[model samples]
Target chain A: MKRSLKQFRYETAESLHIALFQIRANKIRSFLTALGVIIGIVAITMMGTAINGIDRGFDKSLAMLGYDVIYVQKSSWSTMGQWWRYRNRADLKTSYTEAINRTIEDNPNSNLLVAVPQMSTYQASVQYRDLTIEQAFALGTSYRYPQTASGDLSSGRFFTPTESAAGTMVAVIGDDIATGLFGEREAVGNIIKMKNSRFRVIGVFRKQGKFLGLFSFDNQVIMPLGAFEKTFGKKGFVTLRVKIRDQKQVDDAKAELLGIMRRIRRLPPQKEADFSINEQKAFKSQLDPIKNGIAAAGIFITGMSLFVGAIGIMNITFVSVKERTREIGLRKALGARRNTILMQFLIESVMICLIGGLIGLVTSFLMTWAIATALPDFPVQFSPALVFASLVVSVATGIISGLAPAVNASRLDPADSLRYE
Target chain B: METSPVITMRDLKRHYSMGEETVKALDGVDLEFLKNDYAAIMGPSGSGKSTLMNIIGCLDTPTSGTYILNGQNVAEMDDDELARVRNREIGFVFQTFNLLPRINCLRNVELPLIYAGVNPREREERATEALNRVGLGDRITHKPTELSGGQIQRVAIARALINNPSIILADEPTGNLDTATSQDIMEIFSDLSKAGNTIILITHEEDIALYTRRIIRLRDGRIESDKKQ
Candidate 1:
């Protein structure tokens, strides 16, 4: 057994040497054969990178919504497009925030922390001098709105409770709004016009990128509820943002909030509450299927390219076997076993695939880097796990493609092959 | 004193089916060779000499017969066992020299030892010594394409001798060479035979056959004559 093992080792070494020599001798042919694998690996890695980036971007957007906060509104975030089911429901009242807060204060064991009312519209237009910004998200909320939202103020401070209650003409502007109106000048103490009303900018929020690449948090103008009511009327959409005691205990908090909301709406236990309670998890559940669809399509396309590549390798291997019939016979007569010949061809194809996979990885890395550099906002990430997976896939393809041709070479008749011209 | 035969064959028969007809490649033959016997097998075309050489070299199995080589029953052995027998007991020199053109002379000669699982250092040492014995010691790193026809044949002979096989089987070893190069190769064989290596030559050329001590002629798959000079 020991002797046989030694023989196997020697044979394997010899086979490896032969494989390298063959590949080196046929450099152009080998590269062409490897090109298919290269394209396949690139497709797979790029798709993986895109998917990873999307996941990261989604998580970032979700974080912007505040993990410990849930919203009570008329329309459900998860089923956002089917608005007819919610159209008949009574519009949520901004007064619900006061009622919810009172209920929490009365109950010492309540999971709810505080409730802040928000009213917003996407059609608001703001102007400073001759410059105007359209499609600005104009929001109205109390001074406690900061507790249920992300992003700290980059300059100045949130509105004081006295200012909120007095309905003062003051506003907190987003980074984009500040930049659009004031440019290099400090935004605080500057007055901007909204419709026929003039409001002083008291604070400027830091830049936060788009939400799932759809809505931008940096394009909003926030003010007190009384000031917003004076500028845009009370007909705007309302959402009651409720902060929770702990993010991990969100289910308990949501159940408690549902009871408070039902009592506030004066609904009996039998009737379903008219308002929908939503969290970041709703967006995740809604987007996961689209993400999975993209992944499935990417895999099918990558598989097809790899299949073509395998066929190319197999065809080349068959041609190699046919070309070296005499060599096979000669090796056999010199006492090389059937397995030795098989191993030689297998190693050749595998080496080609491995090299191709490495090249593809490097190419994809460069591409991801270029994408990240060219468009910083575009999601594209390359991970070590992707590198590892592509290499394994390459080796498996080599083995699968090389098996039949190698077997054919191994089983050739020595005597007849020797006589071949 | 009597010695055990190095090779023994009894009632060897090999048949092949060519479409609707059966071609009897080898029909019932018995033979034996003692150690250090230098002989030539002579026959016209289709006289079964090639088939006989193949069976003797352990490249093919007989349809019905017993062939014993170096005390091993080669006829009953499987493919791998036959490969082992070929590696350890027989060294074949082909008509075209069969030296792998891309590899150097030393690597070509080390082929058999590689299969026998010899270590690289020892394999190189033995291969160099064998090449030196064949008068091509200085050309160890030269490829077959760089060597002359006579030199390539010598490299093949060196490869055959590297494992110290029990019998050196030369099938048309000089068929591709000119008269002068053929004589040079024959002289090398003569020197090897004198050095106590049992050799078998397959040839139709009378001059090549005349160089051996014993000659056996075949006609139509049967031995026609056997003589000693």
Candidate 2:
């Protein structure tokens, strides 16, 4: 057994050397054959890169939503944009946040942390002296708002508890709001006009990029909920942001919050609550199917191109076998077994594919870099796993394409092949 | 005491079916060769000499009768087993000097040992020794394309002898060479035979057959004569 294994190794080594020599001697033919694999690998790697970029961008957006936070609103994020289901539902009251927070504070073992009630309107406008910014997101929250969110204060401070309770006309402005209304001027302590009332800009938030390249977090004006009610009306859009003790316990936290909200609404035991409890995971569940759909379609299309490429390789390998008939006869006469001939052809095709795969990886890496440099917002990534997966695919393609020809070469009659003109 | 023959054939037959007709390529032929025998098979173009060479080289199987090489009945062997028999028991020299043109002389000579599963160091050593024996020791690194016809044939012969097989089979070994280079190749074969290597070759030229100690003539797939000069 050991001797056979040693012999197999020697034969494989000899085949590899012969394959290399054949490829080197026929450089143009080899490269042209390898081009099929090159195109296939490039398509595969680029597809993988695109999918990776989409995932990376989604993860970034999820991070901005704060993984540890969940939201209580009228419409669920998982069923997002299905406004008809939530249209007839009553608005989620901001006062429910206080009740939830009170229960969390009393229970020592609760997975719930803190809840911040938020009210906002996108139609609100802010004016500072002669400059005005329209369609700015005007939000209302309390002293605990920063705990459930991600951004940090760039200047001044959030409203103190006493100020929040007093309904003081003090606000924390977003980076875009501050920059738009003041334009490099000190925004803190500056008073801005909104809806016939003046409110002091107590703080400005650091710049936070957009979510999924759509909604901007930097364009908001956050103030005390009580103060926002007098200006934007009490019935404006409302959401309750709840911070959980651990993100891993989000399901438990959501269940706990659901019970709390049901009690706040005084719902009967048999009746279901009208509100929705949501987390970042809801967005994932909603988007994952779409993402998978894109991936499945991309893979099929890419697989088709690779299949065409493999057929090309198979055709070229057949021609190669036919061209080397005399050499095959000679080798067989000298002592090459059927398996040795098969292995020689197989190694040749596989070597070509491996080289093609490496070239494709390097090409995709450069293309990814160039794309990132040209459009910094474009989501595209090159990963080592992608490299590994594509190489395996290349090798499989080589074997699948080489098998028929190699077998034909192996089965050639040594005596007859020697006599072939 | 007389020793047993290294090669023995009993009623070997190879027939080809040609469109409803059976062409008897080799019909009921029998032969024997002792160890260190130098022989040539001579016949005309459709005389079954090539068929005999094919069967002797283990490249083809006979339809009937047993062929025993060194006491092993190789007639019934399967493809892979026959390959092993060829690798271990036979060396082949062809008319075209069938050296792989891309590889150097040393690599070409090492081809048989590779199939025989010899390790690299030993394969190189044995191949070098065989090449040196064939008088191409200085041209080990030269490709077939770089060497003369005589040198290429010597490389083929070295490859043939690398495994030290029981029989060296050459088919029309000098048919494509000039008279002078043919003499050189025959002289190398002569030297190999004198050194106790059993050698067999097939050719139609009597002058080429003169180099071997014995010659067998075939006609219409039957042995016509066996003569010793």
Candidate 3:
């Protein structure tokens, strides 16, 4: 057994050497054969990178929504397109935050932490001095709003609870709003006009990127609820952002909130509640089918390329076996076992594919780098796991493609093969 | 001189099916070779000399009867076992001096020991020594494409000798060489035979057969005569 193992090791080494020599000798043929694998691996890796980028971008957007917070709103975020289902529903009142907070304070074992109310409009415009910024988002929330949101203040502070209760006309602006209105000037203590209502900029949020490349978080102006009501009226969309005690217990928290909402709505036992409780997970569920569709289509197309590549390798290997029939005969006559010949051909094809995979990986990496450099906002990430998966795929392709030809080469009749012209 | 037989064959038969007809390639051949015996098998185009050589070299199996080489049954062995027997007990030199043209002379000569599972260091050592014995020691790194017909044939002979097998089987070893180069190859075999190695030569040329100690002639598929030189 030891001797046979040694023999196998030696034979494998010899086969590898032969494979290298063959590839080097037939450089052009080998490269052309490997080109198919190169294209396949590039397609696979690029597709994987795109999917990874989408996942990363989605996660980043979800983080902006705050994982530990759930929202009580009129329309469900998951079925956002079919707003008609919620058109006749009563609007969620900002006053529900007080009732939810009272219920949380009453129940010691409640999964709820604290609730904060938010009111927002996307059509609001802000003006300072001679410049006016249009379509700036305007949000109204309480002093405890920071506990349920993601951004941090780069300067100044959020409105105090006393100021919030007194309906002070102070606004905390996003980085984009600060930079746009102030432009290298300090934003804090400066009064900005919105809908003819004057407001002092008390704080500025640090820059946060767009959410799913759709909504910009860095373009909002946040003010106290009462001040927003005075400026834009009380008819704006309302959301109750409730912070949970534990993110992992979000399902229990949602259930608890659902019951609290039903009680608050004073619905009969059989009548459905008018409000929808939504979390970041609803957005994820909504996007999942679309993401999966992209992935499935990408994989199917890439798999077809890999399949074509494998066939190319197989055809080239068959030709190689036929070309070296005399060598196979000689090796056998010199006492090489059937498996030795088989391994030689297999190693040759595998070497070709492995080289191709490496080249493809480098090419994809460069292309991704170029894309990321040219368009920094476009999501394209190359992960280490993708590298590993593509290499494994290349080796598997080589084995699958080389099997039949290698077997055929190994089974050739030595006597007749030697006599072959 | 009486010596123990290194190879023994008893009424060996080899048959092949060619469509609807059965061609008896080898029919009722009985032969023996003692230790260090130098012999030549002579036959016409249709004779069974090639079939006999293949069976003796363990490249093919007989349809019936027993053949023994180095006290192991070659007739009943499976493919892998036959491979092992070939690696251990027989070395084959082909007509075309089938050296893989891309590899150097030393690598070509080391082919048999590679199959025999010899380590690289020792395989190189033994292959060098065999090439030195065949008078091409200085051309160890040269490829077959760079060598003369006689030198390539000599590299083949070195390969045949690398394993120190029980018998060296040469099937038309000088068939592709000119008269002068053939004589040079025959002289190397003559020297090897004198060094106490058993050798078998298959050739149609009487002049090449005359160099061996014993000659066996075949007609159709049976031995016509066997005579000592």
Which has the greatest TM-score? Answer: 1
Q: Could you report the DockQ of all the candidates, in the order they appear?
A: 0.79, 0.72, 0.76
For every model in order, the TM-score on chain A comes to 0.98, 0.91, 0.95
Sort by TM-score, top down from the best: 1, 3, 2
What is candidate 3's CA lDDT for residue B116?
80
lDDT for model 2: 0.90
Fnat of every candidate, listed in order = 0.61, 0.69, 0.62
The prediction achieving the highest DockQ against the true structure is 1
Give the per-residue lDDT of model 2 (tens digit) for A84-171: 9898888888888889889998999899999999999999899999989999898998899889899899999999999898888998
For model 3, the stretches where C-alpha displacement exceeds 4 angstroms are A106-109
Q: In terms of docking quality, how is candidate 2 classified?
A: medium
Between the candidate structures 1 and 2, which one is better when assessed by TM-score?
Answer: 1
List ranges where model 1 is wrong by over 4 Å: none
Could you tell me how far off, in angstroms, the CA of residue A16 lies in candidate 2 after the best superposition? 1.2
Runs in model 2 deviating more than 4 A are: A99-113, A127-132, A178-199, A244-256, A259-272, B1-3
Shift in Å, residue A82, candidate 3: 1.7
Candidate 2, residue A370: Cα displacement in angstroms equals 2.8
